[model samples]
Target: MPTATRVVCEQLAPTIADLAGNQRLVLETIARDVADGADIVVLPELATSGYVFESAEEARSVALRRDDPFFARVAELLTGTDAVAIFGFCEQSDGDELYNSAAVVTATGVVEVYRKVHLWDRETLVFTPGSAAPPVVDTAHGRVGVMVCYDLEFPEMPRSVALAGADLIAVPTNWPFTDVPAGERAPEVIHAQSSARANGVFIACCDRAGIERGQHWTEGTVIVDQFGWPIDRASGVARATADVFLHLARDKSISPHNDLLADRRPDVYPKGAAR
Candidate 1:
């Protein structure tokens, strides 16, 4: 029998550079969702520091060191809880470079920091690109893989994590409104769904809402099943928040005769090719 894990995606409209207020929101959300029986809670990219930087200088001003007291506060509060939080923020590394990063804070302490591998739009100018693969951590729910915003668009990111034995993928993003033609599923939603099915793992996407620095956001957050379908949400429309069970990700058998992961033909797959 597979164990079930409840996961929640929190969509927030965070004020840019308001680290104190944003930190409050994160802690509060974790408490609320934990009471609601969530085993895993995910927040939007740069949830504490916020997004939309005019320049590298502005981004650096809001970066948090790996040993900042912020994580200590989170660890202090999580001492007796089973919930784990994965959130995005600006990381001020020892090398003096700012990277768009996400951290996993458990009851014990901060376990992992995943730097964003794929930069988006103007982010390339303000943040250093991370060269490491996404980190997969063992949680009570299952092995959780972490990624940020633009990283999910590239199949390689999540696929690499799943291949590394992740039961679920958590993506914290600031999804801006892109021009999707009439009657089309938004690109972000499609990417989440497709990746979940392709990797045969559940996906929890936490996104930001409202405008940031004169730019509008799509605000379409969703939780996808391992088979690539959105879970039934009470909102009856696209919602910024939703919950799903982790055990669903444990099922990789497309049919009784074959398993999705076992069916891969990696031997013949090209290692690298020109796009």
Candidate 2:
């Protein structure tokens, strides 16, 4: 009775400084997910090159152009699959500066690029910040929005897109392991859950896992619904996939009760900030 959207979520252990190997893995994963009946496939952040690059020079060396041969190869694989592939890659721009960027690759072509807006510690030294927020785009599945690693931590990013009419938020992350007591409910995951519940939207957080350059990363990739509940979860570095029906459980009888966006008293809140 519920019309759910099917997506294949992939968790890959990307090898640092190995563009060719990464490309092969991405293509293989795409193929596997497509065969499994995925309407969409989301990969980890900086997927093409592992997240442990030592310097801007290091990141630049492995970064790929939008028109690179590898992207063309990916586009070729996307043909006839009818699945939109969203994945992260280090982008090389005009001045050759690098960006932590994600692209939504449809069967037709690349739809949009959502660059990392909020940079992490080492990332600030390497990549430039994106000034504008990414708007949600209408897709066959629904209205979807994209955000990179650190962007998911900020409420404004998701709030803005949700307010703009996004029904789903696709996040690509590479979270590091910490001693936080929440277990799988890390701050990043909490942020995703809260944002989803507050905005009345679904969230798909695809993260990188395993030891990268000797540092442990969090492997808690999940798909949460409007009630801020996870429908699917991954444990200890493996691939997990699921099909979610948007608006399945949500009915008109359930109105915006704890919704943060709807409850905001913008008149007073915005005035103080404007001053």
Candidate 3:
């Protein structure tokens, strides 16, 4: 088990429809985080291609294939380090379909790609929803799970990954700003906190900043501990950093008499509930 893993979530403002510039921004961000000793770095959803597209054709224009050399450049940045980078991208599948996906990358290359299962608002109009479940990849740092924005809002999504033995859940989100009461956190951040506490796993949600196509974002990048408290949160466009023992998440015991996972009454619960 690893001792303490340094995790970073960067809140970047990506320009809409500028694939080259967005890719450059991603590379520079990763390089800087790696130099700063970030074991795991996460970026917002659609980091490669900005969200809020006017049309599907517009999105397809900036979509990248899994084998795009741009990913190689990202891997090159981690050449001698054990660092891992997970970010969202507009993916062009082998077929005519386009999906909102998150890729987990290391020095070796892309390890796993998880397409967004839950699309929010206009996203359904532009991309096809993924059929597969979230994936947990074992890395030198720890077991990292990948999920895109809206997926994290679903309780089952996080629980399934936790049951699969994920130490940290990395979420790449482009959350649109919405109304929140005074002295309260964004609803999205609340969801992250709830999910983390319920599953007893660390969750890092990387959210984007700035307005795109007149749509303001929540800029709610947060790192939550297993106890469901916010470890760190990004203000405006910045990075939230935290050093935590990834192995600690393996223990699901909340109290001496209660174990989060072991105490589940799956047999009596609804059939569609997370097992």
Clashing pairs in 3: none
Per-model CA lDDT versus the true structure = 0.83, 0.80, 0.95
* TM-scores for all predictions: 0.93, 0.91, 0.98
Tens-place lDDT digits, model 2, residues 1-275 = 64668866687889988888888898898887877788778899989988989988889988988777776676677788667788999989877678899988877777787788899988999898877687576777777889987898777788788878787888888888766864446778888888888788888889887788897887878888877888887876676676877554233124557444656677767754423
Each candidate's root-mean-square deviation in Å? 2.4, 2.4, 1.1
Error of 2 at 162 (Å): 0.4
lDDT minimum window of 10 residues, candidate 3: 266-275
Identify the runs in model 3 with alpha carbons over 4 angstroms from their true place: none
Best-performing candidate as measured by TM-score? 3
Best lDDT goes to which candidate?
3
lDDT digits (tens) for residues 105-160 of candidate 1: 98888999999989999898988999899999998778999999889999888888
Off by over 4 Å in 2: 182-184, 247-253, 256-262, 271-275
Candidates 1 and 2 compared by TM-score, better number? 1
